[model samples]
Target: MTTKVLVAYGTTNGSTARIAETVAEVLDKEGLTAEALPARTVTSVWSYDAVVVGGALYTGRWHRDARRFVRRHREDLAARPVWLFSSGPLDPSASERDIPPVPGVVRAMARLDAQGHITFGGCLQEGARGRVARMILRSGKGGDFRDFARIEDWARTIAADLTADVRAGWL
Candidate 1:
């Protein structure tokens, strides 16, 4: 049987959306039916067999909509397999450090019984916003630091887990 997967994301400068799309592509290639949609578009979790929800980080927090999405769908998400991802931390130096996951993300994970959570680097457009926004953008130490290969590998792992569940008649 085919598994329907929803790859939903919240983005600011759009890096998170790209990450979600890449994950959806990987899942599709793995023979799962997957679609990447904005978090706001997901009205209900009942339509999907599995869900991958992602968001961009700002001021060390996840986008508000993504947090709200998790809070709103916590019960339905707990009844199904779910994964979470955050796109931020453009600083390569910080990549090796173990910062605690964003607070909203932590709550979502606990509430949803999320299968996994991953954090990836994000980008910033030059001179796009004001001083504070620019400062935060600069502090992340600007760069298109996303590792597509790693992202694809993670997607494959998620697909493998879901596929195993399907074969076992547990999905």
Candidate 2:
């Protein structure tokens, strides 16, 4: 059977969802079966061989749905090869450097024993929710900062890691 991967994400303003989709697309191109779904909609992770959980960062905290998803499916996630990602920096810092996970994500990584984690640049365009988001947009701080090339590169790394595991009889 092909290795199936679930790319679950918690996004605000729909930007992180696009990032999740990109990841799934890259994995699919790399000969893996992958699907991108909203974290709140995924009732179970047991059907997949691996998972990639992503969340939007807001004020240094991960999206609530992503945190809840990890908490709700902790046991199943622990048994699988899991990776995590956060996308929330409005600047180019994420693409320019290694932005570490927020405290909550760090804890989740430890609990799930996730294979790896990455932080991607975030996007905040027009019509974003929340008063703060609106303010940021009005102040001209909101823009699409997500780097698709970087996102794809990360997904390729994941595919390589999974492929390696399969060849070594580890997955």
Candidate 3:
């Protein structure tokens, strides 16, 4: 049987969904059955062998829908392999480590003992931000900072992980 993976995400301005699509594409190319879907549409994570949850951060927090999805699936997620990714750091100077996901997201990952958690650069559209946020971004931190190569590499790692787990009968 094929290993199945779900790449669900909550995105603002569609950046994170693109990231999720890339992840799912890599997983499928690596021989896993995977699909990317919005977090709001994913009623549960129980059907998949593994789950990858991605979200965009705003105001030092993950999108509300992503948090709710994690919370709703907390029990099932705890029993299976789970990976988390956040796309948020717009500042090229800001390291991935400097951006933090909301506390609820952290708690969910901790509870699930998530296999991996990654952070990637995010993109912003014009007028997407409010006054204060725009001010902060205008300080030479604004632009499309997403790195597709890096994102693809991470997805490949996830593919390897899922493949190994399935082959070893760990799933």
Candidate 4:
């Protein structure tokens, strides 16, 4: 049987959406049925075997849509394999310290018992911020910090885990 996966995301400027798309592509390449969709638009995850939820960070919080999706579908998510990710932090070398992706993510994770959590660097668009905020961010040097290689590697790992679980009759 084919494993079905959903990569649902919420974003302010579309970067996180693109990331979710790439993750879905990677999972598809691994032979899993995967689709990337906006969290706000997803009505049900009942048909999927696994889910990946991600969102852009703003003032230490993930977008509201993602939070609500997790809340509304908590039971469904808890019964399946779930992974969580937060996209943000302008510094390329930034790690977990920079993520701190709001209390919402934490609550969602508790509700779902997510298998993993990742905090990835994100790009900052000058137009997305106020003038003063843009000036401060621009001062530190800016560029795309999203690591596609890392994202792909992680997706592949998830696919392997799903396959393994099925083989072991754990799925």
Q: Please report the candidate that would top lDDT against the real structure.
A: 2
> How well does candidate 4 match the true structure in TM-score terms?
0.88
Task: List clashing residue pairs in candidate 2.
Answer: none
Instruction: Give per-residue CA lDDT, model 3, range 1-171, as digits (tens).
Output: 898899999986788999999999999999999999999999878789999999888888888878888888888888889999998887653344454556767887788899878788988867665675577567756678888888899999999988888789898
- Once superposed on the true structure, which residue ranges of model 1 sit more than 4 Å away at CA? 93-100, 127-131, 136-140
lDDT of 1 by residue, 1-171 (tens): 899999989987778999999999999999999999999878998989999999988888898778878888888889999999988877653255444578888888888889989888776767645576588657765678787888898899999999999999999
Q: Write one digit per residue (lDDT tens) for candidate 2, span 1-171.
A: 588999999987899999999999999999999999999999999899999999999999999999999999999999999999999999999999999999999999999999999999999998899999999999999988899999999999999999999999888
- The whole-model C-alpha lDDT of candidate 4 against the native structure comes to 0.84
Lowest summed lDDT across 10 adjacent residues in model 3 is found at: 92-101
Q: TM-score per candidate, in order?
A: 0.91, 0.98, 0.88, 0.88
lDDT computed for candidate 1:
0.86
The alpha-carbon lDDT assigned to residue 35 of candidate 1 equals 98
RMSD to truth, every model: 2.1, 0.6, 2.3, 2.4
Cα lDDT, all candidates: 0.86, 0.95, 0.84, 0.84
Clashes of each: 0, 0, 0, 0
Colliding residue pairs in candidate 4: none
Q: CA lDDT of 157 in candidate 3?
A: 95
